[model samples]
Target: MKQVLGSCLCNRVTYACENNFSQFHLCHCTQCQKATGSAYAANLFTDVDNIKWLTGEALIMRFNVAGRSISNAFCGECGSAVPYKSLSGKALVVPAGSLDCEPNIQPQSQIFYTERAPWFDSVTVCKKFDSMPK
Candidate 1:
């Protein structure tokens, strides 16, 4: 599979990873929601060594949720989420939005479904728009 590139909104942090992902999940857990500031977090899991930092490696910052396993790494300049190793260091977690191209696989499942935001279901029935509704 061809390698894919990912970067932050400010283009300060960049990385490359192969399209070989083991799992993709949309997590509705509150922590994930809070971390992403969204209804859920779409994450792709791959081997720990799957990612290669291409630029601004030193500018990356990480926050480990103390007493919990959850952690997030992002660009210090733009605060855009990036790939990081899991607490166990068993796998690399990539924020789906950071990717330059779509993944080869679709989301395998919606994890923590019970924890989904209350308004999560409203979007399906809500008016669709390419941009803000006029």
Candidate 2:
């Protein structure tokens, strides 16, 4: 695998990671949902050593949710989630949306499925639109 580039929605923060992810998980945990403001969080997990910040390092802010190991990193300018090491310091968690290139692999698992939002299960059946509906 080669290095993949990533940036924030505002393009103020950029990073590169060696494509060495060991797992790709779509976390359906409530915390993940809240952090993403969506049904689930698509995260790619890898060793922290594989990540390298390319620019706007000082614009990144991180917070640890109370009473949970879950932590979130985002660009202060645009509030787009960015990669951060897990609270345990063992792995880096990259929000799949932040990647500028497709990951070398696909999501391997849906974790905490039972805790997923009620509407999440119906998403696949929802209407598809290339752009916002008129």
Candidate 3:
């Protein structure tokens, strides 16, 4: 199995995981939106044991929504999302943007579509740019 490296925005935390992912999901749940501070969250799932922390494990912080299965793990220094074990402890959920390279699988489905943010309608409908418009 191939391994892909991942790190936080400030590089405070780093890890490696198998490039083989079981599932990739674009989650539109309200809880996910709030946790990610975005319209949706793109996540990759793999076996719980597939990841190895390379450094800064102590700088990681986690938050679990009260009375919900939702959870998030991030770097304390830069607040960048990283990988975290599933609440059930069965899988590792990787924030797609954390990876140094690309995952082998594309997003398979959108979960909780009904809960998607109203302003998230058709991202393609907006102007496309290689960089931020001045």
Q: Who wins the lDDT comparison?
A: 3
* Estimated TM-score for each candidate: 0.96, 0.96, 0.97
What range of 10 consecutive residues in model 2 has the weakest lDDT sum?
45-54
User: lDDT at 92 for candidate 1?
Assistant: 98
Q: Model 2: residues >4 Å from true position, as ranges? A: none
lDDT of 2 by residue, 35-112 (tens): 999999999999888888989999999989999889999999999999998999999999999999889889999999
Worst ten in a row by lDDT for model 3: 120-129
Q: Model 2 reaches what TM-score against the true structure?
A: 0.96
> Which predicted model would earn the best TM-score?
3
Task: Using lDDT as the measure, name the better of candidate 1 and candidate 2.
Answer: 1
Computed on alpha carbons, the lDDT of every model, listed in order, comes to 0.94, 0.93, 0.95
Candidate 3, pairs of clashing residues = none
- Tens digits of per-residue lDDT, candidate 1, 1-134, equal 88999999999899999999999999998988888999999999999999899998999999888787889998999999999999999999999999999998999999999999999999899877899877
What TM-score does candidate 3 get on C-alpha atoms? 0.97
Q: For model 1, where is the 10-residue window of minimal lDDT?
A: 125-134
